[model samples]
Target: MAPRSPPKRVSISHSFTSFFLGFLIPCINAAPLGPESDRVIKLPNQPATPSISQFSGYVTVNEEHGRALFYWFFEAQSEASKKPLLLWLNGGPGCSSIAYGAASELGPLRVGENGVDLHFNEFAWNQEANLLFVESPVGVGFSYTNTTSDLTKLDDAFVAEDVYMFLVEWLQRFPHFKTRDFFISGESYAGHYVPQLAELVYDRNNDTTRYPFINLKGFMVGNPVTDDNYDYTGIMDYAWSHSVISDEFYHNIKQVCDFKELYWSTECNALVNQVFDIYSEIDIYNIYDPKCLINTTSSATANKIKIDGFKRVTILAGGYDPCYSPYSEMYFNRPDVQTSIHADSRGEKWVSCKDSILNSYNFSVFSVLPVYEKLIKEKLKIWMYSGDMDGRVPIIGSRYCVEALGLPVKSPWRSWFHNKQVGGRIVEYEGLTLVTVRGAGHLVPLNKPSEALALIHSFLSDEPLPNHR
Candidate 1:
């Protein structure tokens, strides 16, 4: 494979520095002193009033290669000092948590229409925890590496290591959060990221002699990419069950495709491509939801972007505006916005998802079931959730992944409620919990913010989802 090309390098203009300092100093003094340099006083188009304390800046994960990861940390909306810390990551093997997690989904501010302003997200997850969003690896979002070779070598292990290092150094910058209960959460490709990073943190926590301890309590993922065999099988089954494809199409795929193998045969790929062709017509991320019609890259283009044999659709936030990804790109790439967030975009413009990173990422791991087995034994809280309407990493696949574990049922599946209405369903296994968000697509928080908030509250508190309406 050819080495991945690096983003262009750009020098910051001298005039921007003057504007940055002039705009930054007043807000800096208003916030508390810890990691003050990274404190974001205000965003360019944020509401005139202040809400929560936010810090955004770079944390170097590798000094040798000049690689650094960018992070935006939001203190809990209230009683921040007493709340646990939650780290959110978005999966593309190459997407930015800043774009999906912070800008659109659970962050305190949602980028407004046309990417010209920001509005408060009432259901922001920080209301329950100190939310931290990172732009990971060496080439996603504002994160970058001076070593061009780093982009080509991207893989699960590489990402986990860099993220782990980021956490360690990030904690050093704000030691108060080091001992706070920490949890990792994300959706989609994050299925791979959240678990792998949890395992690394779990293993490293045991050997504090060489690493700084992270108080990792548990993790949760939504519509995660788990075992390849189960996920692929689930994809076809889901498409058929949901009536996304005809019975004949489904039958042909099952007959020609052997999902158990690491690589699909040409016949299977061809069959799958046919499915993608149909999926392109609808929002594959959320089958029932409308596609972002105005966006240049349609769902067809998104379905073609894959890592290894796994399909990775373009990261989109589902809600009032279907084109949330483009808005994020427009908002974050603004020079003033970058200056406010201390983001140096190198020469390349910020994008919600980077195709180059997805294309180059080495998909070496076939299954994370082994990691799941190990972590379950360690008594860490593990929860898997799915937005039932999501066709990409459907609840069907998540169900199969959970069943494969063969854990005894602690609690039978039952409907869970929020706001006097059915929120979703939940089932508890001996070591894990599986949840489904009703009327939601791939990005649950974006689609059903209230219910997603309720779900997280239940997860973090280790309490049952409300059985009564």
Candidate 2:
């Protein structure tokens, strides 16, 4: 594998910064705060059965602005105070959390046959810490915004403000958890969201400038594609090394693939074709998650062997792609999952998948822009992980992200042996650790549930990971 590249820190500022400060802070209660203008709104949500071992609930974050965040809280119902609180952000800049994080992965439920109901997930992350899976930035999932005319543009800064505002309001609603040690976790675009939000919480923690209700402890990101340049190069390299494409094609993509170019050229398309051809031959899962099966276009014809990719590369959000049909020959259909994810939201009884309750804004990378400097300066902990077989934000892409951090490796990369088999590997650095989950893809919690849960548990409790010296 090639050495990872460091992040090219970009400084960006928008006109909303002033409005952000004004709306976020105000004088109130001689206690250094403003009156709570928001009220928690409960939606018509049915709870997961008791046999499922988790709690489902939603707290209104900004009802007045028509922005509300919905979350699934999972816990074993421990009366113990101080249980860890985990805020999970699903990346899409505009994707639904229930689609990827909830139904497909860590949540205690899996989308069943018709996406009509759920099944108990044995490896739910809530078995350890109280986990909150939220559909953020309004217009995503059951979350909504009253103003229909609002621009749907999802940028970094907008997300941070809404997240911070929600956190403050959420803590107020769940006051019992206000002091609990909190960690933010997410994947793909969330790779950027988690850290940026964490910085905001940390900044407010030390300064008398904003809300002090957030008790943020740490953060985690999986298969993050933060740096645009690194992600493109990393994906191509992965495709080439895995024999997913030819060396010739790889060379062309490496030399000519510029992200700024909105669309792929003929050369790029050809390379993609070759890569998809290779992918058809490889299996996406070991135990065979029926969903991971690839579609092929090959048929024994009079002469040439041909293949075609999926008709639509349906990206629900945050670089997470859930397959509803196989490309080409076998168009495997998971209508249930399709309905559950809003991939087919047009079906009768459809609910908005985007959050409409969030404040009107665009995403800004301000938090990350000044993060490493501030956090690195504070000796804070930042962790990154990835499932091996995820194609959208593959493990190789994650490895590349880790390499760019440029932190000295505290522990060299090595397989994390489990039950006489390599489950994953851990690379510890000065203030960060990058991990790879074996036998798991895009959604680790779904493909490798037990392992994903265990990894997160160890991360939260500060336990030394097994097999790592």
lDDT of 1 at 243: 92
TM-score of each: 0.89, 0.71
- Candidate 1 Cα deviation (angstroms), residue 169: 0.2
Per-residue accuracy of model 2 over 1-469 as CA lDDT, tens digit each: 1122222333323222232343344334333111122221221122345443333334554555666666555553353355788888887556667666766677665544223335566777777777777877666654555666534444565567677877776665555566678888998778778888888778777753534547777888887756655666667777777656677877877776664343556676566565555665544322123333323223322111122453433433322333421211111123333322223222222222233323333433422424655676577667888887766677776676557677787788777755566779898988888888886776677566777887887898788667842
lDDT score of residue 102 within candidate 1:
97
Instruction: Report every candidate's CA lDDT.
Output: 0.83, 0.59
lDDT for model 1, on a 0 to 1 scale? 0.83
Candidate 1 runs further than 4 Å off = 1-33, 296-319
TM-score of 1: 0.89
